[model samples]
Target chain A: MRVSLKTVLTLTTLFFISACGADDAADSMWRKLPLNNTVLLTLPHGKVVIELAPQFSPKNTAQFSKLTQQGFYDGTKFYRVIDGFVAQAGPKDGSKKDLSVPILAMEADFKVAKDWAYTPVQQQGLFAQQTGFKDGFAIAYQQGKSPNSGKAWLTHCPGTIAMARNNAADSASSHFYIVIGQAPRYLDRIMTIYGRVVHGMQHVQAIQRTAVIEGEYAVDHRDFTEIVSMQLMSDVAKAEQIHIEVENTESKAFAERLVKRRNRDSAFFYNKPPPVLDVCQIPIRSRIVK
Target chain B: MRVSLKTVLTLTTLFFISACGADDAADSMWRKLPLNNTVLLTLPHGKVVIELAPQFSPKNTAQFSKLTQQGFYDGTKFYRVIDGFVAQAGPKDGSKKDLSVPILAMEADFKVAKDWAYTPVQQQGLFAQQTGFKDGFAIAYQQGKSPNSGKAWLTHCPGTIAMARNNAADSASSHFYIVIGQAPRYLDRIMTIYGRVVHGMQHVQAIQRTAVIEGEYAVDHRDFTEIVSMQLMSDVAKAEQIHIEVENTESKAFAERLVKRRNRDSAFFYNKPPPVLDVCQIPIRSRIVK
Candidate 1:
């Protein structure tokens, strides 16, 4: 689906119109993400909305959903924050043993069949055979032995939410982290990525980073950013809830956006280089609906 | 030159042995960057040392040097900080009109000739024909109409120091920014890259980010992170100076490091992915000398 710039602009205009009290118009263009699959994390500065990727990591997402429903993440502190890496948070004492929830078997949903319609950005990525987007998430696919047999996994781009585990693969319970800087592609297939930050990334970036001593983050409990409360969007009252609509990766507008980003011809550029695109560099637009 | 891992490890061991107080051995492998070309930017958290890239952008580097010598950056505030993007700073009030230094002619040192020996990482990049490291900076080179005729420019990777310009290509003056998140490769060839943060990037990342309103950062001067002082390292007393040594891009050790980063068989990685590397992911190791 090839969308022209004018058409995309029109679509964007329509999107805004829908956002500004025009529910019917907005509903036609933007698909509302399931409220049950969304999580609202409140910080002192603002609120961060996360959309779970259940199709990719069902087990991990289910466990996280169960934990959030039980108020397990409320009052948890972001204990470890390494600059240009990740911001890890959970219980203050780092004791997950006391949590009532059973440890989830590790779901390293590293790859999926390439059967789903995906927009390929590159034939090869920094650490993957192919890179593209799947349901608004940046992803990489392995080169299959056959044409349609490849597997795809979520790329560790900034704002990715993943389950934190111990040396054992099945150790992931309540601890989780958000990628806060350059995409740490090294962790792509090693950890289970269940969701991504859909809004309020600035709040996550505002969290005070900890000092590093001998390559380890030296965090103080008192200085940690407190999680005011975490609740599934569905669990919140309708009046107080915030709804999100992610730009469909399969849509024509997204294709246009991809092209515009790949080849920038702004007045600021003295020398326009050839168009090369990274999957993470392509932003998936997310809008809030009150 | 392709260097074997054993040889690199041996050199590293020797380098560590030399670092154990043997000033002579340390000086041999590491070239001492001219202190005159180095800037010490003091932040509330710590001092960030930036090494000028005079070879790539001579005019801009000279202007920056003069500005530092004249104490133009003293008491300046990092007024604009966007998470996973950039930390911009200069004279407050967003005015360079009062600065004593002459406004430099825009030297958009986006690309250089591929004459110097460069360790090429990829035949192609997201926006460039080729990607590699030149003099310890992540760079992309234009695909020349003919071999050896294309130009190269510094990439907008984390810690890269670039001149912030207005809409006009040549309007850069007293404003600059350091990339703090994922590499915004789209900015390549558009801005003037004069230097890079060699040490204390953690301090750079620690700068408090401002709130966002309608996609623009809402900065409050009262909450700004102050630039306590900015001075050339040479201007300081020899006894108080902090020296740095960047890993030679043309050296054998760097090549080995690149390979290791691309493919990891570490205990933590349950399933190691293919060895694909991004030039920005290959860190140019820089350290302080006693």
Candidate 2:
């Protein structure tokens, strides 16, 4: 509860650096995710994790790991959020469980390997001509010279998760969605995102929206938000897991935190900005381990 | 409760127009806002409006209409929201106002008028080298030719709003905030934006977020988000007015909504995109005229 611009209000007076209780103690500028393609979910207030990207949507991360190991996204009910845009969940109409899983195939973009541990970040991207970071998500590519050019997907940014298809680009299965605002860029290469919450994006920005403008009040069914289960962090139980890590956005201290987030040699800035860096306002960090 | 991706899921299955119960009846693509430079705010979950850019932060929208006409942002509380980023509110420390009102004057970049009504919308902008829309906010300019060669600011997209100074570029008096996610193009030209929440950006994305993380819970004070009063929609009361409108971003139906959002010739897109648009994902329609 501080702001007289003294204890950090916002719209800048420079307050960047609260990757919560920080002190990375260099685990080599962070790493971990991909324990059999992570995931945690759980919500009624917290526990989101996620990760996935199985090398860029392998059959939608193997049908979201066979629908969260068949607990099928537990109680599923973020029934279509859409505040800054998107929260969605499962079975909203996609109807429940099993049926030999099927329906997927549009990894939207993929096929990277011409040396793809990519880490660029933005060289003019409002619709990619370059934008970056790979493993921890947010991407864009196709800078050809023979990698069969133009591939690489995932870029909806804000905690992206993707999958919930319809106009038939192979209509995704177990319904999905997450983004939560700002980086829509018209669903770039059209959604197949696969995963990325890497630790509760504030429980996915505290989902619950389902749109309601004027004097509000219309989202009921006990106002949704459910999904109280979903595991697979290699099946959680090691005294109740939850380690997470992240930040090695191809480290060198994340290219010095992307050149201190693209130039702000800080003096609380006196009109400087123009080295440019809005890879969705870069904040890679992600922590939580004790 | 549909997601079987039939009734529009997100990440595109096209849910484009639902500017809520639409049907504008051609009031010529909307207009209004500027009733003594609008504002409304209120909050136990409804009413926001805002709209003040007195031609781009004129003395912080006249010190936010003289501290929202003296009630000084009623009950103040959104004490720092920061989920996708930013919600802030006044006096979390800026104290109970009126130190003879004065504390503005940065207006972070203005001086347009090389035939101003701008409108363009994007030519590669991740930190503007062209991005547009003028009277309905989201801007960026300067394309030099001697009118002092560089100015035109307002843009931190998402429901913007600004003002909350500290490191002294004319300290900005009563704290404010609002951009609520994604467009923190590093606080564009660094803060002084003034207003825009035109129509309760879903009650400012339902504020109440002050950082939490592990199984959440740390934003107590009855979990903040209070500000329940604020007026000056020319001092309300014409049977509770709220006719807003807005969508004349140099009309011709907003240049056919920026050419159908820069070529998304719907067939619900079958791998098309790359005609770029992201002027904060272009949606400019706003409404509520009854």
- TM-score of the second chain, each candidate in turn, equals 0.83, 0.31
Model 1 lDDT at residue B90: 84
Q: Write model 2 residue lDDT over B156-248, tens digit each, in one string.
A: 888888887887688878778888778876678778887778776766776777776544347787778899888888888888878677776
User: Model 1's A-chain: what TM-score?
Assistant: 0.84
Taking all chains together, the TM-score of candidate 2 against the true structure is 0.32
What is the DockQ of the complex in model 2? 0.15
Q: Would you list the C-alpha lDDT of every candidate in the order shown?
A: 0.73, 0.70
Instruction: Give fnat of each prediction, in order.
Output: 0.27, 0.37
DockQ of each: 0.29, 0.15
Candidate 2 scores a C-alpha RMSD against the true structure in Å of 23.6
**Top of the candidates by DockQ:** 1
